[model samples]
Target: MTADMLIFFIFVLSIFLGFELISKVPSMLHTPLMSGTNAIHGIILLGGMLVLASAEGFIQHVAGFIAVVLGSANVFGGFMVTDRMLQMFKRKK
Candidate 1:
């Protein structure tokens, strides 16, 4: 098989494993895990912004720009929800 095909197979396998693990996680672990995922999603937003800024062609630029905006909104919204969830667990002084 070609290198690209091999890589694709590996990627699919990894995704399957990831879903398997996610499905087995306890309910109580979901919040913390989601918070961590949101942080990673924020990094994705940054990468999307960089791509949008560096794109050359008009079509690519517009598409990348939309992706960046949507990604940023997702990151921000995720952080907001995660923050509120975390706050609920904090003890008052």
Candidate 2:
């Protein structure tokens, strides 16, 4: 198999594994899991930055820019949700 095809297969497998793992998480653990995933999503931002730097054409540039934007949004939203969840557990003075 070609390198690209191998990467694609791994990506598909990871998607399935990710879904299964997430689906099994208890509701009480979901916030912590999301918080962890948010840190992982930070890597997405780095990937986006790499793509943006290596972009060689208009289409590539646009796609890379979009990836950066979406990754940023996902990271931000995840942190916001996680923060809200943690706030619910805080002891009031």
Candidate 3:
């Protein structure tokens, strides 16, 4: 198989693996798990940047831009939710 095909297979496998792993976690652990995954979303943002950098057409540029924006929103929103959850544990002055 070609390298691209191999990578695509790996990517598909990881998506399924990730979904199964997350689905099995207890509800109480979901927030922490989501917070952890936010970092992985940052890696997605990097990938989007690389795609944008190498983009060769208007459609590619638009798609890359959209990917980067979505990744950014996911990372930011996840952290915001996590921070709010953490604050719930703090003692108010």
> What are the lDDT scores of the predictions, listed in order?
0.82, 0.84, 0.82
Candidate 1 lDDT, 58-89, residue by residue in tens: 99899898888888887887777778887786
CA RMSD of each candidate after superposition: 4.0, 4.5, 4.6
Candidate achieving higher TM-score, 1 or 2: 2
Q: In model 2, where do residues sit more than 4 Å from their true spots?
A: 1-27
User: What tens-digit string does per-residue lDDT give for candidate 3 at 45-82?
Assistant: 88888999999889999999999998887777777778
Give the distance in Å from residue 30's predicted Cα in candidate 2 to where it truly belongs. 2.9
State, as a TM-score between 0 and 1, how close model 3 is to the true structure: 0.60
Please tell me which model should have the higher lDDT, number 2 or number 3: 2
For every model shown, what is its TM-score relative to the native structure? 0.57, 0.61, 0.60
State each candidate's clash count. Answer: 0, 0, 0
Among residues 3 or more apart in sequence or in different chains, the pairs in candidate 1 whose N, CA or C atoms overlap within 3 Å are none
TM-score of 2: 0.61
